[model samples]
Target: MIEARQLTKRYGDKVAVDGVDFTVRPGAVTGFLGPNGAGKSTTMRMIIGLDAPTAGTVTVNGRRYAQHSAPLREVGALLEARSIHPGRSAFDHLMALAYTHGISRARVSEVIEMTGLQSVARKRAGAFSLGMGQRLGIAAAVLGDPQTVMLDEPVNGLDPEGVLWIRNLLTGLAAEGRTVFVSSHLMSEMALVADHLIIVGRGRVLADTTVRDLVLQAGGDTVVVATDDPAELRRVLVGPGVEITGHPGSEQLTVTGLPAREIGRKAAEHGLVLFELTAKTVSLEEAFMELTKESVEYHAASTTGRAA
Candidate 1:
């Protein structure tokens, strides 16, 4: 498990992360999401002890990251895809890291195979492709089989296949009861993989909820109805809290503040035949945009930024 209680970070006069509180439980993938400059990276850095917090606290399992006797064995992190030694071979790099904790050559080989880096295991870290480097980073992260794994933009430079691979891998790790927290800009993939989300904006926590609940919150009681008698349907359904649009000029009626079943029943009572009736469902991306629209840090003014 991971906990951040009123966690905060500041630089001089700028506050990067404000007081934020959230929890990441085991056996599920938790997405860490925010727009650029929303302080997501700063929060993640504080979790791993890369940046000291100005106030509050963050803990992995039961202790701060640096307080652990064997931090890597408890929390595995992939903050950067290319943080390895450039001059060393992929195999050599893993060997050096393993040597520090008495992890064996077989263990390194296991991770190499697990990450599908067998072909490039002997290649210099500097020459590896972006996708390969990401794989290597993931290999190192899971080398200890840690109970908690946190990754920042793990699929940034991956191809379709690589993206699919990482998706399955992350979910599989979480299935083993490991706490998986990931930050990514790919909303579609986040919808498929993440069980919960922690959204931030302007250095403060905006929402921490499940994917299902977030979408539900964004959705409404709007139902789309297509009927032969549009005018009659509108007249019958017209009432308090019941809005009927797309009528008179068209064959459809967008009825808000009513369920599909209620709409169908109401139309039938008035002898109106519904060609189609569907309760509109809000997609995860749509819900995310609607929820975080106010929290977006960067605004695109126009194609007119400067005198180009």
Candidate 2:
């Protein structure tokens, strides 16, 4: 598990990361989400000791990353996939990393095959495509079979197949009771793989909750009701804090602040015939936008038509 207590980072006069506290437990895939320039990279760097925290502390598996006898075996990370040497082959790169911590050659071979890098294992790292480089990076990360795995934008250059492979790999790692923390800009993928989320804005954490809860909180449960008599149904269901809207002359009513069960019960008591009563679920992207609207640093201007 990874824990951070009041972690802070400052570069000159600017505070890159404010006092942030979070606990990433094992056996679950935790997604790290934020807009660009939200201190996510800074926080990740501080976690692995790439940058010293100005105050507070962070630990991987109950100890600082530097304190571990074999740091790579304790926590494996892929901050940048293209940080490899141009002259070395993929096999040589993993072998070099394994050699540092006395890892076996068999393990290096294992990771190569695990990441599907065997075909190009002997090719120079510099000549590899973006997707292949990402694979190599992942192979290096799991080289020591670390107890914790942290990856930033692991699917950046991946195709559909590679993306699916990484998704399965992350879930499989978490299933093994390892701490899995991944940062990604893809909300749809995060919703699919992550069990929990840590969202940051600016320099502070904006939210720490499960993916489902966040969505429900941001976009409350909406119930769509279809009935022949829309006006009568709206009047029957009207109450304090309950919102009901429908287009003119439409049979469907979009409702908020009430569950399908309660709506059905009310409709039955009022002797109204209901054709449909279904709860509408919100997407993670919508929730993220709703919660972080104020925290977003960049906003594009509205475009009316094609540029001249």
Candidate 3:
């Protein structure tokens, strides 16, 4: 597990991350998300000991990363794929990273094959495409068989096939009981793979919970009912906590604070003929947008700026 207590970071007079506390547990893919300047990279850097925290403590498996005798065996990270040497082959790049942790040549070849880089394993790193470069980076990360895997935008340059591969790979890793903390901008893919989420806005956590729970919190289900006798149905559906809205001249009535079943049962009891009664739950993307809209640090000005 990864834990942070009152984690904070500062640069000159600017504060990138505030005193926020959160945990990334094992056995699930926990997505780390935030706006562009939300201190995600800064926090990840601090986690891996690449940058010293301005204050507070962060630990992996109950010990600081720097204290681990073999950090790579404990955790694998792929923060930047383009850091590899352009002069080396994909195989050579993995080999070099493997040698750092005293890994064997067999292990290097194994990861190369695991990430589907075998076909281009002998190709120079400079010649590989963006997707291939991402694959090589992943191979280097898993070369040591680390217990925890942290990837920042692992699917940034991946094609559809590559994206699907990473999704399955991360889920498989979590199923094997490894800690997987990933960050991605693709909400659709994140919704598909992540079991838990850590959403940050302006460097502070907005949510730390399961995906299902977050969606439920977004809002109650909206029930849409279309009836020939709209006025009669609306009169019967009126009650405390139930809010009904109409679109001016439209026949559809959107009701909140009641489930579809309840609405249908009420309609049947009142002998009202309904054309449609559907419950619509809020989506993850919508929830994220709502939560971050207020916390967004920058906003594009409206069309036609006022006189300077």
Candidate 4:
């Protein structure tokens, strides 16, 4: 488990991370999401003790990262894939890390094979592709076999197969009762992988909830109905706190805050047939955009002085 309580950070006059509180439980994948310059990286850095928080604190399991007796064994993080020395071979790099912890070469080999880096373990880090570098970083993170794993943008540039591999790897790690916390700007990938989400914006925590709850909060389970007898439907739907709007051209009426079953029953009672009555679900990307639209800091004003 990971707990960030009112974690705050500032650089001169600019505040990178405001007072933000969040919790990441074990046995599930928690996604940390935000736009560019949204302080997500800063927060993650603070969690791993890479950056000092100006106020508050972050803890893994029961203690702060620096307070842990064996930090590597408690938490493993892949913050940036390019943190490795460019000239060092992948195998040599892992060996160096193992030497610090008195870990065996067999353990190093296990991580290399686990991350599928066996083929290029002897290759220099500088010559590896972005995808390969990412895999190597993940290999190093998991080398200690930590109970909590945190990765920032784990799949920045990778082939489809590589992406799929990482997805399964993280799922497997979480299934093993390890806490997996990932941060990414990829909404679609997060939707497919994360069981819970922590949405941040402008150096503050905007939302910390399950993926299901976030989607439900977007107020999306509305059914769209199209019919030739929109007037009759409108008249029947009028009053009683029901909203009916014209659906651009045709005699279609869009009813809001109504269930599909009730709409069907009411239509039948009114002797009206619905040409199209289907429930429209909002995608994760769409829901994210709608929820974060007002929180976006930078925007280009259109000709009407509104955001473009």
Q: In terms of lDDT, which candidate is strongest?
A: 2
Model 1: per-residue lDDT, tens digit, 1-308?
A: 99999999999999999999999999999999888999989998999999999999999998999899888889989999899999999999889878877788999999999999999899899999999999999998988879999999999889999999999998999999999999998989999999999999889988999887888678656788998778878888889878788935788888877889988888777788889998998877888889889988788888765787
lDDT (10s digit) by residue, model 4, range 1-308: 99999899999999999999999999999999887788999999999999999999999998999998778888889999999999999999999998887778999999999888999999999999999999999998998899999999999887899889989988998999999999988888988999889998889988888786777567565667888878888777677756677855677666667777889888899999889898767777788888788778788656885565
Clashing residue pairs, backbone N/CA/C < 3 A, model 4: none
Q: Which window of ten consecutive residues has the lowest lDDT sum in model 4?
A: 247-256
Best-to-worst order by lDDT is 2, 1, 3, 4
In candidate 3, where is summed lDDT lowest over 10 consecutive residues?
Answer: 212-221
What global local distance difference test value does model 1 have? 0.90
TM-score of each: 0.87, 0.89, 0.88, 0.86
Question: Number of clashes in every candidate structure?
Answer: 0, 0, 0, 0
TM-score of model number 1: 0.87
Candidate No. with top TM-score: 2
User: Candidate 3 or 4, higher TM-score?
Assistant: 3
Per-residue lDDT tens digits for candidate 3, residues 83-155, read 8899899988887777788999999888888899888899899988889989988887788899989999999
Q: On lDDT, who's better, 1 or 2?
A: 2
Worst 10 residues of 1 by lDDT: 213-222
Q: Which stretches of candidate 4 lie over 4 Å from their true place?
A: 228-272, 300-308
- TM-score (C-alpha, index-matched) for candidate 4: 0.86
